[model samples]
Target: MRLWLNRIGDISLREQLITQIIVGILCHELTPGQRLPSTRDLSRRFGIHANTASAAYRQLESEGWVELRHGSGVFVRTSRPNAPLSPEMAVDQMLGDIATKARKLGVSDAFLKARMRRWLALEPPARWLVIEPDPELLRIVICEMEQAVTLPVVGCGFEECSTSVMLEGSMPATLPSKVLAVRKLLPTGTELVTLQVHPVAPELQAYLQRYMPEHSTDLLGIASRWGDFQRIAQTMLIAAGFAPESLLVRDATKPGWKRGLDTTTAVLCDAAIQHDLPAGTRAIVFRLFDEASIKDLRSHEENLTTPDRN
Candidate 1:
């Protein structure tokens, strides 16, 4: 039986092995009484430590998916197990397969981890843990989510969510672009939610209609510490027929990024860095969550908070 191992991501190497073995049994890829590769062989084949391979086999045996025969090797259980495998078992199998393929294609461990994290985080979060690489962007997401949902919301950098205190029974959330990186740090079974930003065209058009005249040459400024946010904002503005040259983009994480914005017609920024804009600057603040995102958040929150009647 082929066992796919993912070296990076929030799921540990041992958990990945155990999950894959169980999946193999459930799918009949590993049949009853089928002997599995020895611990040393498994370690050599998968580039893992011998102890990790041994621990994986032991876990499978403990979980009743396999049996260990002294002086022999591990074998798939011949009899039916007491409990049925969950749908998530199939998901685990798919993840393993993807990891294996990704490794073969010369993908970087960091890139694979990011991809896995994003896919894993597609599940809705219980409570919101806003993930942003930038401190300013993190605070903005938390604030926006708080206003949109009744559930508790907090903010942190991508690295901060790895702590046990931050992850326990909490849902980690972030902008769509950062989902992969944040997901890589979360433990298995942790739910991740992606917050969608409202498209800028409709809102920007409305603002222009209300504040500026036809064919006006007013410069529009977009500011954010997050590169994704800046890019998305720029794309939306250009797509809405705003000339690229008329838009001033600023990366607030860099020093002296605040200068020259006062000359623009209006500065558009994420809520977090709005305070840092030049005094008396006319600001069009963009929100992180759209109406659909709010609805999804409400549904997830309700599912978590509402007890099962059954």
Candidate 2:
């Protein structure tokens, strides 16, 4: 539906699912005592691998967020702090948006083929990261996303020594199992792309390319509405193996505040610029990384740098 998932930060699909269910239960979108879809059904519904769906359920159980009966199905057991009770409203609005997009396609056969081709050509990703210039509150959400996606993230810190943690090449020899997701940062002002993530959607790709700005990592030039961005980010995480942590949102909105307030209500840094800008003005500097597309320019043996120790 109109996913309340924040598109910013590096989250995995598992994290987003957990957030959705938790928020769903807390906000009454998913009623308490109602049975959840089996992990198989849920996986199909969410386009997730079944095993991953099962893991998410287990995580929810561990969190005391839901209860699993022998065969009765999973049930909501708790409400998260300040969770919205507007599930119905959110769903309605989300469906409306989906309808609008579908209608825009207008059943064009040729247009549909191109869209399908794009989807088919895309590869499954393994990692993602979101580095907000104002790193405080965003860090919390990033941490949650790492947990949700079950993938290690980078650039969460201003420190450079942790560079090895990135899926980047540590050596120039050997073959790696996969290419590392790398953020190609330029040294010059606007030439630099500060945020090392993927763009929300291809639909906004043209829009993003138009923006000329200076940064440490690339920023999404798409300029989509905040709500749309939230969805895109959620989708990326889900695809990359992370999920958003909606339950962690802290309502930082304040009346009469200007410039830095993020209207999305996600726990954003106090310097988010939403509170500082002119009304209707917003800035989104995030995208997800599809590690599969990376090239191993280094020795594969030492390429991963920090291989999964466990």
Candidate 3:
């Protein structure tokens, strides 16, 4: 498995590895009995100390997530049938689970109690609150959601999500990349929807196959108000064998950002701002979400509005 580790981040390397492994297990990406990368391999590949990798694997084993075979490598713990639970045992187990989740979210006992009480009194979600770090990406997500579902869709940046009032009566949604970070800031028992991002690499490759021969020397433009999108597009193009000099990147956030984009053969942009490009400029629109995610959002809206007859 490929793991991305930041050596300079505030979180320790061992802890990061543990969290990522656990997340993979929970997401079903690491299935039961799957062998994990060896400590020596992790150390050599990631440039971390061997001791650090061993410590992380040890912690995971202690937490019941993996098992260390004496000679074989560590593997995910297989599932086992649970013993029958009495009524009182079941209740206690449920409460314990709640406490554990709350602690992870940094909620004090008092705050948990207060929030639980308030949640019991509140009605169902009236809208979606999309949390994204980039304002341009936020607008794109909100626009797509607004089109897919009937409920109102609003958005705020990561900094703005700190205000608790914004979460009231709203279902929180974010990109898959931000789920872990956003979950930490949410209250216990809050359900978060991970918005799906469209897969663009294949489309990019096809574009290259179809157009590269004729447009080899043409100046192709990558336009987006979001810096990350532009950077990612440029990287993918370069990796696909496009010459860096033949690419023109325009950040829509700057003044007169569209002034020179009309000169390019075609401008690749996110769906939200495609119409804003120069009238005659050809646009290769890359939508951020696929149809399946939009269908899921629509189903969620239906469930929320329809009465639970049962």
Candidate 4:
């Protein structure tokens, strides 16, 4: 129940409710083996329309916050802070009780001041980061604070994300979801390339926590070698009633293709145009990988560019 409320942040009312649920779970107040309150219960508790409450719950479920069994209500996912923080996190929770008690008993100002002074005297935290579901999610989300193109990035072997920390989660690039991308960064005198994607996709987030032992959102870029996902996304758009005329193909070498072996990406886009791209289509370009792994079918491009000796 409280699990869904914790993810909301600076969004609409819908976002707040969702974040609250997530926060509730992360604080360990919602624990692993807990069942969520029904949608109806949440609606009545927060005075929201049932549909809105249902949407919030559904969104969280989609993000792997909670699960819904056929005959069972949603359950708190133990898998993903993306797990609760240490039990010691509860120490701060006592403040609420102390405040309540202080109000009830009218504690002396001197006593409260002494306690405040003691609290301020404590050492600063060793590390400070929002409790992430897993370490990978934590690492990736941290870096995504700036949507800068990664430099010498490595995936940390995070194949799937466990949580949706914006840019890092298994976010749908095609879907109208929030995602971050880094533009190339190069100084006039310095040639060092720098770019990074932060936060992680939900699938990658979960996987990183299970394997990698790192903390930083400085994610290595998802390999765009073959533009595999790009081709797939273009195809999907074509199939979904979006005309090729509306499609924007982007990639490494559209102009350089006439002379040699073409990249699979370019070939795929060209193929889509012949079969699917309407005349005068608008296609986006991708510039990460060079021709082969990127542009189109190299073999066919060779044939087209090969000198006919006949």
Using TM-score, give the best candidate's number: 3
Clashes of each: 0, 41, 0, 73
lDDT of 1 by residue, 112-223 (tens): 9998789646544456777777776677778777777886888778667889878765777777668778778887656677776653334544775564332336688999
Between the candidate structures 2 and 3, which one is better when assessed by lDDT?
Answer: 3
Give me the runs in candidate 1 sitting further than 4 Å from their true place: 1-127, 132-137, 157-160, 174-184, 207-215, 235-245, 254-258
Q: Supply candidate 2's per-residue lDDT for 302.
A: 34
Quote the RMSD, in angstroms, for model 3.
9.6
Give the TM-scores of the predictions, in the order they appear.
0.48, 0.30, 0.61, 0.26
Q: List the residue pairs that clash in candidate 3.
A: none
Q: In lDDT terms, how accurate is model 2?
A: 0.43
Sort by TM-score, best first: what order? Answer: 3, 1, 2, 4
Off by over 4 Å in 2: 1-10, 78-274, 278-310
Q: What is the lDDT of candidate 1?
A: 0.73
Root-mean-square deviation per candidate: 21.0, 23.3, 9.6, 23.1
Cα-based lDDT for every prediction: 0.73, 0.43, 0.78, 0.39
